[model samples]
Target: MLDTDAWWRDAVIYQVYPRSFADSDGDGMGDLPGITGRLQHLQELGIDAVWLSPFYPSPQHDAGYDVADYRGVDPRFGELGDADKLIAEAHGRGIKVIVDLVPNHTSSEHAWFQAALAAGPGSPERERYIFRSSGEEPPNSWKSVFGGSAWERLPDGDWYLHLFDVSQPDLNWDNPEVRAEFLDVLRFWLDRGVDGFRVDVAHGLVKEANLTDWTTTSTILGGLDPAGPPPPMWDQEGVHEIYRSWRRVLDEYPGGRILVAEAWVAPASRLARYVRPDEMHQAFNFPYLDAPWRPAELRAVIDETLEANDAVGATTTWVLSNHDVVRHASRLGFPVGTPRMPGIGAEDPQPDAALGLRRARAATLLMLGLPGSAYLYQGEELGLPEHTTMPDEFREDPAWERSGHAERGRDGCRVPLPWEADAPSYGFGPTDASWLPQPATWAEYALDRQQGVPGSTWELYRTALSLRREHGLGHGSVVWQEDAFAFRNGDVLVLTNFGSEAVKLPPGARLLVSSEPLDGDGRVPTDVTVWATL
Candidate 1:
């Protein structure tokens, strides 16, 4: 079913947002043992691997993206021993593990950053970061990806650049020290038996050599902008060199270690470069994630993604939701053109819950049927919706402070998950403590309610994932038709009717799975996807 050279070609990778997955102790935080304990859910869900987001020591400014240390686990999550056990436990269940690697920047509290701060301007320590002298002003007119100036002035009157938050100082890739350090970081994890890494800000490790001023007017930025050329700080040519060196580290390890890029590049064609034979193994299909739910938009992205990856002999990866943005379920409910803020609040218009659930289920079937690897964000299989009503006082995302409360930030989507319908903390722990509050409404979607119920959301995931492997759907070849899409891998034929009305099935096609029951007339309804054998 999978490509022989690459184990990830058609694998299903589940993402675990550590802080929200499950809490082990009563301290109200998710930890490594909590994840290890919950391995049964993933094993039952039928994913081939699990991608754990960063659990490294941090100020939590960017939710562990700014790593204070690369070699050890943060005490809040657990010690290094807990992580080693988690990896082994997952492996025992036949699931590979991929950890997040943030190479673009490090937490300001990192020893190197502290040294840079204490050493002041023109010191070799400052050379480890991006320090420039433009006389009290920032080096350039560029903006931070979060908000405000990309540069922060130091006590010495010199400025240092941070493309992300001020607490995250960008590393100097031009410096040999930075490059060697990250290579060792990769080895450190690989030696720990991790299968690979999900490289954060993969395209941002290297900036343009000149550090020129930004020429664009669009302040709103995110993964792979739809309307603009590559920004000055992203998708630079020098990045490929860094990846090439890192790729060597992965190759050194056995068991097919890989590097999955979180690179947000455009045109699909440019993204293909990251997956060339010697670079990273795969890049997130952000273009598809950003696409509207319209049939045309979705179709174009699939075609471009497949074509580009085919050119490089690499696999394409698809994802529906993650920790950083609005959940796909809620996003699909809003009017097609509504602005998608990171977090939702009382001021925002409510989305249609019923419509959102239907579309989200349909989207899942569609994504799983596609040819190549897929990623499932934690809680999507349980049909979780974004917690749009998180109170202002509890908000902790940097975007909240950065946006001056005008934007709600991403706390809603990061809410702790519900596992038991009636238990305190919804069975996220033995007690009712969680880093982020679980909504009262989450009981309706708890895993306890969904488990073992035929035609339930949990069963749907188990069935689809099982069928995907049984029928080799992940490595299929897709064929598009009017108002519908179909694909074949081995004996499976997955078809979807994106049109507004029901449609008759192809002759002799026996149904294997459907997102919703068929109508009395046996027509495939709009916003439904089905698997069949012809």
Candidate 2:
């Protein structure tokens, strides 16, 4: 009999950024009840699971990623009961729940950090975190991922490592207490009925002892060279041991509780190490996400990813956009080979909305047709474009200040979702004011506007997801075609045209779906995807 618990392997998981998902109480910020109220939307959208971003007690310094308390939800989101309810309610609809676990660092306001600050350097309390004496310079020249220096100085003539914003202090995993604490944190959520965890900075929990600086820019968090020598700060051999222990903890629970790593390692082989049968179940396919729309590049990434995961007997996960980067809709709208940046701004070349939406829809079909799991960021179903024109004054991403306002940060992609047209907050809530401003153009793509509309992006996503299950295409091998981005998933074949001209469709197969209307001659147009039953 097939095991039912391993739902994660090919699950089409939807990612929810809590503060922007929904605003139940009209506080202008999304909360737990808001997510609960909107669970039906996900159920109807045909996802297998929902991976929520961090909503733990926090200073909101990094938008809840800098968790202050691992065991409790922030009051702004709801209490512990709401979390329990969200889990139970989601499971009721046959959707599994995976919450974010930020083990890499904690908010400086955390009890341990607060106690360490009061205990000063060298004390046992201070040992819980990375602390060094100020001797005319920082411990090293490691820069913070957000910007500036990775080390922050305190009033007591000692410095602590942040890696991110100063408000987030990196925990010293070498300490036994730290490891034991995270084990307990895992149990705490597992006990709460969470099916799994999306570990934040999974490659960073353990650092090299010497704290050697690669002098690699840390402006991107563990910005180690993917093709160069392994850096001292990330993807250390020590991280695997940590996961081995975590794997054991997960096994103690039933229902196949899983852990998904957010490791940024590369070359496919190094990434395979994190999911070797005994460790994590899956890791984000950042390499695939970063690949441009070119057919050759996209095909190569898929081949490399499949080969790597095949080595470890693990599943590969494909994600296009997330909270941390520019929306793929806008990103793909740029010139075919342009780089994907942290954020888009008014000064930057604006994306061609019509052209971008076309490519995005095609990308969605292409991603879902792959032979592994897929993740959908909150508003991608509506074909939501990034709010590239957010007012500079309202920008709050740490990157803005860290880069001296030169980078513009990630606020553009994080604007609240529009649910209804001509309604307050576009029906994201009863109020018109959301934490981040919503662009007026979003109304055209609101969920209410797209529901039941034929050929809308939302309908396309729904049809694709439904077809994925009916054909069991998610759990198979691919046979790549040399001429175009074409591959077979079981009895179905997915073909995409990245070339300027039309590509002839394979004969003798039933056409199931196409991203664009078939050309007059019924060929696949540029930037289009089509599925067929072979």
**lDDT (CA) per prediction:** 0.86, 0.89
lDDT of 2 by residue, 1-534 (tens): 233237778899999999999999998999999999999999999999999999999999899988999999999999999999999999999999999999889999999999998987789999999999968699988888887889988888899998889999999999999999999999999999999999999998877898887676765633346768787778889899999999999989988888999988887888889998889998999888888899878888999999998887888899998998888889998998898777888888899998999999999999999888999999999999899988898898989998888788989888888998989999988987799989879899899999999999999999999999998877877988666678889888899888889988877878899888889988889999999986
Candidate 1 regions off by >4 Å?
A: 1-5, 215-229, 337-339
Candidate 1 backbone collisions, by pair: none
Q: Report, for all candidates in order, the number of backbone clashes.
A: 0, 1
TM-score of each: 0.97, 0.98
Alpha-carbon error at 479 in model 1, in Å?
2.3
For TM-score, the strongest prediction is 2
In candidate 2, which residue pairs get closer than 3 Å at backbone N, Cα or C atoms, i.e. clash?
144-150
Question: CA RMSD for every model?
Answer: 1.8, 1.5
- Runs in model 2 deviating more than 4 A are 1-5, 221-223
Candidate 2 achieves a global lDDT of: 0.89
